[model samples]
Target: MHLVYHNLRRRLLKYTWFLKFLAFLLLVSTAIFLVFKIVPLLLKFPVQLVNFLKPPQSVLRTTSGRTNFILLGMGGAGHEAPDLTDTIIFASLNPQTQDIVLISIPRDLWIPSLRAKINTTYYYGEQKQLGGGLILTKASIEEVLGQPVHYGLAINFTGFTRAIDLVGGIDITIPQTFDDFKYPIPGQEAAIPEANRYEHVHFDAGPQHLDGATALKYVRSRNAEGDQGTDFARQARQQQVLTAFKDKLFSTQTLLNPNRLLDLKQTFSAALIHDLSDAEILALVKTAFFNPPNLRSGILDTATSSGLLTHPPVSARYDYQWTLIPQDDHQLKDYVRQLLFGQ
Candidate 1:
């Protein structure tokens, strides 16, 4: 009977050892599976979360590390030839140097192919298609500059005023007091008395705050005496207002207020046209924040001795239209290069 009890104990010990070995094999198999398969699944959420937290970039279209935009400003409804873009600015941004150059393209510059002034290109294009105006404008500008244009933007005079007002107006320092005796009154172009069609507008010298209507008059006044009467002066004033408006728009007070942003968004939606995506715009904002731009400006003018362009003699070939043309077509490209690159 004692021998029988010893044999049973030995058998029980062997069975217990076999069960322990099976348990060890199970643990080993599970660890191998987790390392090869289940671990990736567990890590996926964290990887995805990290990606989600990353800031967005690489949205803007660029050429040779530079981004170019064509900006157009038009007289909105209730003005004669309202679709005509009077202000054409070529805005180029160099990301590495944070240099922004604004080159003003003369509105009265003649385009032989179109048989019209460059400013009228936008109008004719819009008559052809819905967004063709900007496309044509970009193409024309590219042709003149001999470079690629990445995008186009357009805003009308009405939107300009509303935008200025929304930002509580902007301050401009007039270099000299000027008067525009022939400033055309809106909706009075066909008034019976030709003299009554225009209203005299004046501005005092020194720094002053301008509301919407007053700012509009300030920028649109073209018949001021002496140097102020020239288109170059007009372009300078436009650029000045643009700079002031930009400063006001990006100020801390404007940024922190949600209501102001919403209003400005609505105003822009109503008045502005562009081909930029939200991501692209956000990228621009990000770039500006990280690298503030050094602003520069140039105007293509007909300054008798020191200008890139000159006025052609009166001819029926151009419908006797007063227009400016580059003195040397070959020199235009070089001039634009210098204006943009300082090279």
Candidate 2:
């Protein structure tokens, strides 16, 4: 009877020990499942991060250390040939040195064998329903200039007007009197009669207050007299418009006024197509204001801008095209490098 009692006690103790061990194992398993599985699902926060919480870097910057961008302007939805990018500007920013540079390519710039203007590459891509004008144009510009654009903003014609209006209009100084008999009338040409739609527009020299439509015409009209009519003049007008725009955008009133900010945000959000997220844009704006850099501007076709870009000889196939092609890739690369990097 003593031996039986001893064995029974031993069995009971062993069973109790097993039960405790099992309970502890179960607790650990529950913890592992909670941490490795359930917790991640509950958090659900990987996609929304911009560069995974670090500030966004410039798109132009390369892994090797160069940063630059291409800015394309097109006619937006509801405009004829909505994808035709009329403006192509390359920008470079050296973060280490805080130097900023911009160079403009005329819409008449052409690439060989594509039967497409460099400006229209995006449009052609969109027409094919491939849906990546940004990619197409970026590639073409790189091919043409021997420089690549990592970051880009493709603003439409309507966006340009709306952005100006949102900023309460931009003030510009017209350097010369000019006129365009062929300034395009916006809206549906198919719906409206041709005679009623097309009208002669005039811009007088001197300080002028311009609303959106007038502002757009002021910079874009290439048929005006003096420098305004020439490609170089139009580019000058474009630079002027950009200066005015930057001033207004960074004005104390615009920056301080909540209503103005909201309006501007709404207008730009609707009008522009860009790779930038809200956070990235904010970071860029902060950089622009907090660390304003020296801005240098250039146009590719100007006589002083390396002189490699040239109009085609009077050939029916090329002359009627009205475009400029680089004499050699080497010169093109050198020219762009000088403009972008101050090299």
Candidate 3:
């Protein structure tokens, strides 16, 4: 009877081991399936879209091992007009530290002989000038900041709105109540009639939800608050939108959702123009998401006194000036270097 009991115990132990082995195999198979089948299919959307839009360019090999880019917004003429760049922002990322910095350049900031607004750089390039808009803009910015602009991505205003919507609109806080005169919609030659243009898109200064169109209005609206109706106000709004965007993009659900990824790729595919290779972009994306760095922002303070260039030709209501980087510009450059290089 004792011998019989021992044999039965050995049989039970063997059965338990077999069950454990099977369970381990199931878990391994699931993980492999996700990495090989699921992730590849989902990531392909952005990869293909990016390829279609910019294609890849040969980039200079770098030992600094840091990735940097410029995010440009062009407010070209007409709905289909392609002229100068309306906005230029330098964005830098440090893979090791995951820090980011965005610096905005005023389109009208005075550059020698180039009374032409910054956005006009693209127009100048398109005119078959010696250098294209991107080249001219990069030269101007590099002269001002004393650094190399490794790569740049340009987005149209419409594309910006579409991308925002694709990502599921962003949330922002209104600082005050204000009015936004209706501006002509792209492709519509007739000015939005003055009467129809004066829509009161007002919101109390506080936390609120904003859709893509409304958020565009919020950032582009200069007269929303009586006290805030200048380029400075616009810059602040731009920064706010950017921060909100980063937050949304980094959200786990947004990053992980295959549908959202595809939508994002499709929405911005036509609008985005970049000069980075697929490998570089993938590396940068991985670094940004896996190891994020602190983000910092600041504006250039010019010598021109307030209200000096209150009324410029194109948009009389807008302000302009011959802005100069402060004498202590090195401080700003150092901050940027630290953010980008993680040194």
Candidate 4:
């Protein structure tokens, strides 16, 4: 009877050991799965295209502090083409204070140094290969503002359209009816095709829904009413679109879907070029969404506009110009500081 009891106890001990071994195997499998299988798949949709494009060591830097950056949008003449920056916006963010400020610089603003269009900074940068167009544009903006542009992101218009489409289009309220006679179609030449172009955009001056293509037209149409008949109006429209898109992104439905997040990353990846790392972008997004401050929109006054003149030696045909920036640097700085630090 004693032998029987001992044998039963030994059997129970063996079973316990077996169960422990099985649990260890399961844990090992899970670790392997995450390390070898799941991790690689997850990394495929990285939000760090800028990092991939320009490694940290290659990027140029100036003195670092809480400052602003310019987000330039270069609308190419055709698909995949690299053109001068058609849209330039200065954006400032303070990580500690969570302040945000955006200021749009008109593309046609005259810069005297270049003796060409304000957008010609891209051309100069590309010619010198300093940092492509973005570097030269940053320098020009810094010269204008009397403040350094810490970094910039230059995206092609095609990619911009794709990003809007990925977000399922942006809803914009048109304040007036307008005709965009020269809206260029993608894959076409610099000149707008007469047959393909829509001469009149007849949206009433009220809240209206717009798709990616229509939104592009809406912002690009300067001849429309209340458009200032200049690039300044275009800038305002662009900001409106950006604000609407941001609102949509923060919506509960879009934020909850992993698939939608991945789609957004992919969509922007094709268009965006920035100096920020994936980690930095994630941190910025968190701050921007959680405790966003009021976003003020303005442009350089008319007094700042320098007249257009042809650039010597580069090209007699192409004209360039420079515009005066705000006279008070402290005002600009203080405004940015308040936005970044204040509630």
Best prediction by TM-score: 1
Clashing pairs in 1: none
Winning candidate number (lDDT) = 1
The pairs that clash in candidate 2 are 60-67, 60-68, 61-66, 61-67
TM-score between model 2 and native: 0.69
Score residue 117 of candidate 3 by CA lDDT. Answer: 52
C-alpha lDDT of all candidate models, in order: 0.68, 0.59, 0.52, 0.53
- Give a tens-digit lDDT track for model 2, residues 1-343: 0000011112221211112211222222233333344345446855423332343354224533556667776778777777777667766766545565555666776666566568788877676665477777777777766766776666666766776676788898888888887677666466445666556889888999898888878776756655567766765677677668767866786667766665655555565566654444443443454455555554443343444556676466653677666656775676566556558
Mind giving the per-residue lDDT tens digits that candidate 1 earns over 1-343? 0000011112222221112211222222233333343346447866533432334234567776678988787788988789898777777878667776666677887787777888998998999999999899888888777768998877777876887798899998999889899999878989888998999998998999999889888877879998899876876786677668767876887767767766766676677788876455545544554556676654433343545456778798778999777756657676566656667
Error of 4 at 323 (Å): 6.9
After superposing candidate 3 on the true structure, give the runs of residues whose Cα lies further than 4 Å from its correct spot.
Answer: 1-60, 63-68, 76-82, 92-101, 113-115, 129-131, 170-177, 182-200, 204-209, 228-256, 303-343
Q: How accurate is candidate 3 locally (lDDT)?
A: 0.52
For candidate 4, the C-alpha RMSD (Å) to the true structure equals 21.4
Q: Across residues 270-335, which tens digit of lDDT does each residue of candidate 3 receive?
A: 656666654555444444334444655444333334322222254322234433323344554554
* Model 1 TM-score (2 dp): 0.73
Give the residue spans of candidate 2 off by over 4 A: 1-61, 129-131, 170-179, 187-197, 202-208, 225-247, 277-286, 302-307, 314-320, 338-343
Note the clash tally of each candidate.
Answer: 0, 4, 10, 13
Instruction: Rank all candidate structures by their lDDT, best first, as comma-separated numbers.
Output: 1, 2, 4, 3
RMSD of 1: 27.1
lDDT of 4 by residue, 99-122 (tens): 445555666655556665567788
Task: Report the poorest 10 consecutive residues by lDDT, candidate 4.
Answer: 1-10
lDDT of 4 at 304: 31
How far out, in Å, is residue 339 in model 2? 4.7
